[model samples]
Target: MLVAVVLAVAATVGVVLFTRVATRPEPAARPTAPPPATAKVVRTDLVDRVEVDGTPGYGAATPLSGRKQGTLTWLPEPGKVVDRGQPLYAVDAVAVPLLIGSTPLYREIRADVPAGPDVRVLQENLVALGYAEAGPPDGKFDAGTGRALRKWQKAAGLPQSGVLAQGDALVLPAAVRVDRVTAQLGAAAEGELMEVTGTERLVTAELEKSRRDYAPAGAAVEVRLPDRRTAAGTVRSVATASAEEGETKLVVTVAFADPAAAPESGQVVVVLTGARRDQVLAVPVRALVALAEGGYAVEVLRDGGRSLVPVEPGMFASGLVEVTGPGLVEGAEVVVAS
Candidate 1:
């Protein structure tokens, strides 16, 4: 009976404890709030002026024999640095058969001779090839003109022909040469015969017309040569029309402002494009949270608080993108702590 009384008392105590534990109230869960606006980051970009590849070309053109493409003569014997007015070719005076009638300039051919613009073009091209001797190519073959022609012919080993043959060559424009046969030995040439060139810039590059706008004038540009040498030059000229290749091109001509040596012609090179930003709004791309509702939003922090605002994105250059949307006014102290 005593043991039974003790066991009963223990059982009553256990029951009282269990009831007390079960009656205690449970701790409440902490509430969760929406993420603050300032927590999110929006990327931004700005419109910028950029540069494209362009090449320095002869501001002028030099004419060559149009007779088909004769057996590629001497190809400007490699390594000859002929100077301005330097003789490049000397054709034998033998009466080469002319498919096209040969008429001396004295009669000057009764055909509609180019008077003003056409002559201007000739003079300009002649000056470019070092044949016109730097003065305004007056289109009149005066003594100075004869002197230049004779100088070139003499150098070319042609007879001291004071007479400027209608198809005689003036200079070799390009530095490369290839073997090509274009006319019948006894046939004739109805086009330009002699070719010539102008001064050499440290490097040369060609630009496609599509990228013309990007290659602004006075752009800081550089050219990498095969020897790993980089020559610097400014944009001297930009061709306004599409080249004969049928591709619109902006020939950005650059000459080494301070070149150790003139860049060799006919070398392949890689051109680089660069960009800069002036004054514009930029935003983080990731900070742009697309709320399922509509429009885009960015987080902003003020006095330890956050706010959300929508924005309209604009042109992007490099890493930054331009934006002008809700909460994005010019000079509106936006934070880009990152």
Candidate 2:
């Protein structure tokens, strides 16, 4: 009986051990996540910029009124570029030419008139037009001046009077492109006659007075055209305009580096670079990883492995962040969240 009991106890112990082994749950599979995406550490230049709206066209237009007192017999076609010594319009069948000067022809320019700045301007223009052979303009209407005036008059199909009348020629600062003909052909030539603008195409933009430093004169900028092309440009001028709604504004004019590349008319983007970094280690901004230690770090990938390296971030521009750190070479790769 004792031997049978011992054998029974042994068999029960074996059965219990087997049941415990079978009932034990398999080791839970540890949760895992795929590796993060990555990008490269590129060496590139960065330019911090401010973009603003700009309008492209021939600069501002100024009214070209008729200074001659006569019946308007002829007018230049719109879009005609009137240069110095060229006939701007005809007055009663007499051509009134264009002259480059600041002073208008308010009185007769002849030998008998008092010497003045207007005479000097006329003499200078005469010399420029190759109609006069004289020294620098002395402001005196001498015999040479009379000869030059007569020569110009003859060339313009007018009688050689040797005297410049009160309404002889029109004076403007420079050559102008006729924008619009405001006067009719048969109307009296007295008031507003036409509108003219500079021949060069320029981009005009309005900037808030507080942000004037963003686009100072002579600063370089990039112009993004309506067709998605870019062109180099320079800030030609900046002027303060009258305050509107109690906020002052600035008028900024930009000229194309190559005028041929400028479009005739369209709204453009003016990119003003405020700062630049050259030949620096850069990466996509997304590659920047915030650290729990109060600084930034980048997960650098090397030799099929990745390690987080602390980096000092610099200027951020064009979706790139300038980074600097130990062992951060140009060709190295960095982790970026997908």
Candidate 3:
């Protein structure tokens, strides 16, 4: 009877153990930890730059017109570099030299001509040509001026008339590169004989009204040439007039510091740096997260734990964004989406 009791008790114990095993819940599924990807906040220079397509060529071409009308006997070849006292073209089989001056020749300059700015221009050119020995560049036509004119005429193989008529010479702001000869060889030397540009090469870019601030006068820029070479350039001028287009556009002219290093004419890339900051806290743009509330935030990682910290984003450049905020410092690790 005791043995029977023992067997029954053992069976009861086994049933209780099975029931406990069935009722006990499986260990809670282990919580998963997200995969880690991070980047370090850095302090470096950040620049806000705009890259635009540019045309590398001699800047705007100015039309060249002659005051005298005659057969265009000879013309300078395209791409010719003409300087002061050099022949721009031949009119009536006589070379019409280019003189450095801003005043156009309007009337005849003779021994008894009235004092004016045009007289001053002629006197300056004569002095530059080694004819005037003593005297300031006065705007007066006197005996001394007549002597200089006679000498110039003699040297140029023209009659020693001691007089300069309109169209006797071409006046230009400076030396130029012949861009094109518009008139035929035998065409009349009247209007728009040719077009010329400054001797130095330049790049022209059209900036939309929104980007006008990107290229300010005197701002330095980088130009990438067609041959894959780079050159340093300066913003020469910003046009006040807007180009006619669907959008308002401003013309920006850039001149190379070393024009000889620039390509003659081709497509180029112009990079204008608007603003820059140095030694600023920055992080990869991917590290920034748009906060649900407002503004931006970066995940600050510390001791294997990440906490979103609000930040003020400044210039965004080169896949990096300038960041500033409380608890954000250089060398701090930040979480970035992989």
lDDT of 3 by residue, 1-338 (tens): 99999999999999999999989998999889877788999999998889889987878888888778889899999999999888999988988988899998889988778899998998898898888731367988888888888888889776689988888888888999999989888889888888999988788888877888899899999998889888999999887555556556777899989868788677899999977888899999999999888899999988868798999999898899999999888999998988
Arrange candidates by TM-score, descending. 3, 2, 1
The alpha-carbon lDDT assigned to residue 89 of candidate 1 equals 36
Question: All predictions: root-mean-square deviation over Cα?
Answer: 8.8, 5.7, 5.3
Screening candidate 2 with a backbone cut-off below 3 angstroms (N, C-alpha, C), the clashing residue pairs are none
Error of 2 at 308 (Å): 8.1
lDDT of 3: 0.88
Full-model lDDT for every candidate: 0.49, 0.88, 0.88
Candidate 2 achieves a global lDDT of 0.88
| Model 2 regions lying over 4 Å from their true place | 1-31, 39-44, 51-56, 134-136, 185-188, 205-211, 224-230, 239-252, 264-270, 279-283, 287-314, 323-337
Candidate 1 C-alpha lDDT tens digits along 248-270: 65556565667554544545343
Ranking by lDDT: 2, 3, 1
